[model samples]
Target: MGFPRWSRLGSDLRRAPGRVRARVTTARGRGGPSRRRSRTSHADPPRGGSCRPGRVGSRPHLRRHPRGHRGGHLLSTARSGDSGGECPLHRAAGARDISRCATSPPRHREAGGVRSLVRQPSRAFVSVRRFIAFGVAIVVIFSTLTARLYDLEIVRGDYYHQLSEQNRIVRLPVPAERGGIVDRNGYVLARNIPGFAISVIPVDLSRTREDELSQRLAALLDLPSDAIGDVIRAQRIRNPYEPVRISKTPVPREIALVVTERAELFPGVRVDPESIRFYVDGTLYAPVIGYTGPITEQELAKLKDSGYLPDDDVGRTGIEDVYEQFLRGTYGWREIERDAAQREIKTLALQRATVGNTVSLTIDDRLQKLLDAELRKGVDEDKFTQAVGVAINPQNGEILAMVSIPGYDNNMFARGISTAELAALNADDRHPLVNKAIGDRYPAGSTFKMVTGLSALSAGTATRDTVVNVSASSFSVSGTTFYDWRAHGSLDFVHGFAHSSDIYFYTLAAGTPFAPNVHGVGPDAIAKYARMLGFGAPTGIDLPGEDGGIMPDPQWKIATFDEPWTIGNTYQEAIGQGFVAVTPLQLLNAYASVANGGTLWQPHLLKQVTDAAGKTLPIPQWTSQKLDMTQENLRLIREAARRVVTIGHAYMPNLKIPIAGKTGTAEFGASAGKDSAGRNKLGFHNWFVSFVPQADNTDPTAQIAMAIFTYDSSKSLCELCLNPAVGMTQRILEQYLGPNK
Candidate 1:
């Protein structure tokens, strides 16, 4: 058999309910709860005038049609003599009809018998039957319905009561204001401004006036006409009464326009107060301080479980992100009573918001501004991509100045920038958002030698008098050659470091036939020493995103590149190349350690914290650890660093303050050998790192230690205050330690 068509089967099932009822009733007991024979089947209305069950007025006409001639219609014509004009109704039912008419009892004769009965039985019997049937139906239905009602009202009362309560009361999320951000001196960095957002109470609006209301709102809010329609359409899919934002964070002009002209057209439109971010000082501390914007979708998802909302502003970078918890105050809310239409009637309960605490940094505004001015001057003269400058007090490891060039105005984020402005900022090649002092890592150049000299001395690798001959400026190891800026004939550690003799350090690193372990003392030793001086890790400064510069080892080489560490790699790194890298801040810290007599102090950028009431809060002070070094070894390294500034090396002169320093001309890209003047046009990192007034009987401690890292892609030294040891040292001593103090 062919597969059954479900459409035809469905129709047949719908039409056959009478048969179904008869079958089901017989299968069950008729004596118990007699089921009503409800007509479930539906069929198309019969052709012409068929006797439908509805009206008794049309029944006589239907009865006459079966009697043929009485209605001039044929019932059956098979036995009729006239084939063409024969009446089928007459042939099929005329005889039976005549017999029924002849033998059937008359209604009048029955009525006549009814009158002879005592007490008028006809009227009494009819009334009695109807009354008994009606009473039985009423009792059965009422009893069944009453029992069901009892079950629902009492047994399942708690379950239904909770459901009803949920339907009546809606728990809404209250938007909390974000905390304010401030500088060390209580200057505001980021803040909230009260603003308004337009919303729609969709269910309150009439469907007939929806189009007109949408158009009027579009004009008032400066929104696309379709936007209003879309909001209404979306609400229709969810709860129509729930409030949905039409224009989030609408401008003041937009809000005013709506209130003025289109007030009557927008019954559902309302202004909701919101917060906007602000930044007072624009480019002064842009990179170090960072900015804040709207929370992104991806960030929102990550913070959704933490109870963040769509409008909440979070820290995007720098200290804003670093101390987000402390900088972002707690959010508060209110319990409000709302009408049936979800319009807030009044606030039943309110909670005052707590603002975030202000942060005080070790950075001095005066010193920072001066440092920025100096860096800007350097950048303009050199025409470099970027520049950074850092100054610190060696006695306490306090960062006095930190400056980065090519700063940006944070005010762009204050007013909630459009998509185009944000894209332009991010797309700039100069990377205005970058914090160069801590974020960028460059080779510390020759300045890193102080760490090598100190670490090797402490590690028993090389001594102050460990002499190595240098016939030429360049040195060779394992057939690979490395060269210095100038040649130095026969020199000790002091002379070698003062002249930056690459061959001298290379010879000690290559390990002469005299000392087998001496050659093991190449870049690996330098890197080890570098880490010991806090070169390869964060200086523990209270800044965000401090790049721990790379210091490669044998394990690092194998893990990162699946290659063996080579002697040439070590030799290149010994000269602060190959895989060696360090931030300017790290270089300064290393020299400061040597200046403070082998003490490694953690660089601190925060001096103290306080409450709004002016009560001082307990905070950790600066601390340091001393390296185990003999006084003789420290004296040798100290003299070597000091001579670089005072003695005639690279035509640089000694300072009036008797400062000890080193000038490193590291060949980085293609121009490492040239001076800071950019004459070679390749890239070389010029470094001058030093300490003041070598420790002695008169002044056992150096007051300040400073390092200058200036990169010249053009290879011109004149633009960088070439050999700035004398000038930089004089300026620092004059400001901090001179008679002006």
Candidate 2:
């Protein structure tokens, strides 16, 4: 009861923070040895008893000391059960019987001097496992941190480094300069001029101040504020990152200076150097060269992968459209380092732009001018609003000059045509926007008679010696009568061809009751010869939008009108009067075949091409085909055509240089209203096509063949009508052809 159990006491004290040793000394008493003996204390070691605190040596055997104490023997001052006697060690262990005490101690020890508490396995700890857990936790935490550092710095370093650079680096596009167009004689037809364009960044302009920005830009551009706002709004909806081009064309220098000099006033506006297209003699050569315009949203969607941007300009028509792939050069870019605010600090790398290829046309500017002037003269003198003229070399079908009156200026389109200007062009009655040379179709008139005449020659139905009874003004077939312009009396085939006798050709096309029994060449034979000489189809010229004019046969007529083909239709088609149409280029090439020993070549405008480095490039291969007519028949046709200019209605035999030609007058307006006299009130289309010989007619392919067509002339086919088309073409040929050649 005086001390703790020996096993637990030793462990508990040794695990404490400090070593403990306890001692007790006898005190000096007044009564010598008796007092000293009474103070001495000894008892057996206690079992099944609690130690008492702070009452040392009252009733005890021996007490263990706690940690951090030295020179001490512990004791208790508690009274024993049923015994109140005082005892130095349980009051009776010193002399009396200790059976009165409830518990007895195991072994007793007496300490005369100081005693120390030093138990075995001395290690300082209340709980050693908790400290071990803390040490392991520290080691694990440090190991995890080291492994994470290895993964970050070594495994994925390059990838994150590239990402860091990309956040500060950007690439900007560099547009290439468009190419120039020249004529065969090196005359500049189209080129590019340095200019500036205005652009606006939608994100740069504050949403609340967008209206003010639009108003300011409208004042400078002379455009509606609402229109400018619409453009900005559209760009913001599409993409907030890209800049939108404010001006579709080049901005004036004065306006560009205002945007660049006063940057604060225009927050989103920027000036960029943009090349503007310049076309020399735009009006004169509009149909041949064509124009360009800015790319639309729909076009950009299709061409985004092809390096085309929203601000790029694209070819619209003619050669510009036909050769667009070559003319549109590849774009370049500049890699630049930028700051956090996205302002470029320095150029990191750059790729230079490659300019577009240079294009040279086969057109002779001088001849083109001549053809244009001559057609203008015809329009004024003949009182017509529309006309077409085309001249080509008979040898290889290279077009020398082509003109379509009521033509528009290509420069206006290149400069961004306004809504009103474009509407006016589309609304004009004469059609200034249409290219009549190749896009429009008309009756070949008597110009088509050569096709029928050749068909009859090949069929052997009518020969040069064959005669037709053209004394009658009209020829009757299938109860439907077809009339000629007038009766030429009785005539031979060659003489009938020279005078353009419709009755003579009709008799050969569909047999009539004539002398020597002229046989009829069926409708298929006529169509065959028509197609053979480049009629009834497009010539596949280098220009865009060519019409394959109508060539009606029995099958075609049944498919179109759902009616049976009558012989009367054959008679009408024989003279190029009904269901027979051709483009101006197709008509000219038809005659070119006859004059050039029966070779009908494909027409082309591009002569050659060169790149930016002055190296020649391969040109596109244009399709060509030769006519299927014999040389003997070609000679016969040439002689008869020469007679048309010498002794027929063309009538131009006085010149030293020789030429051959034919004149035609085609009737139209079957659907027109009646006149004051209650007549059907038909309109006539006048035409004259010719070919010029060199010094001699021996070199036939070296000649130049031309065609002139005037639309809706009142006096084009009247009594004693001079045929203004013939006059215009004859003048052009006289000036264009030389005697020495």
Q: Which candidate has the highest lDDT of all?
A: 2
Q: Pick the candidate with the highest TM-score.
A: 2
lDDT of 2 by residue, 1-741 (tens): 233344543453354334334222122223331111112233311232222222333544455333222345454544332232233334424423232222222122221111222333324352576789898999999999988877777888787778778868988888998888888888999888877888888878888888999999887776688988999999889865557878787865676898889999898887988888889898998988899888889999998999998788998998788888878887889999977655679999999888899899889888888889978876887567688989898888889888999899998887667677888999998888778989998887887889899998988887888888777777565577777768788888778988888888878888776554877898999999898887778898988899999998999999999999888888879888789988989989988878888777889898889998899999877666666667777888888888887788778756655778788888876434566678676777888888887744534754578888888754324532577787777677767665432
483-516: candidate 1 lDDT, tens digit per residue: 6555567777788787776666655554533234
Model 1 error, position 615 (Å): 4.9
Cα RMSDs, all models: 13.6, 12.1
**lDDT of every predicted structure (CA atoms):** 0.61, 0.75
Provide the TM-score for each candidate, comma-separated: 0.68, 0.76
How big is the positional error of residue 629 in model 2, measured in Å on the Cα after superposition?
Answer: 2.2
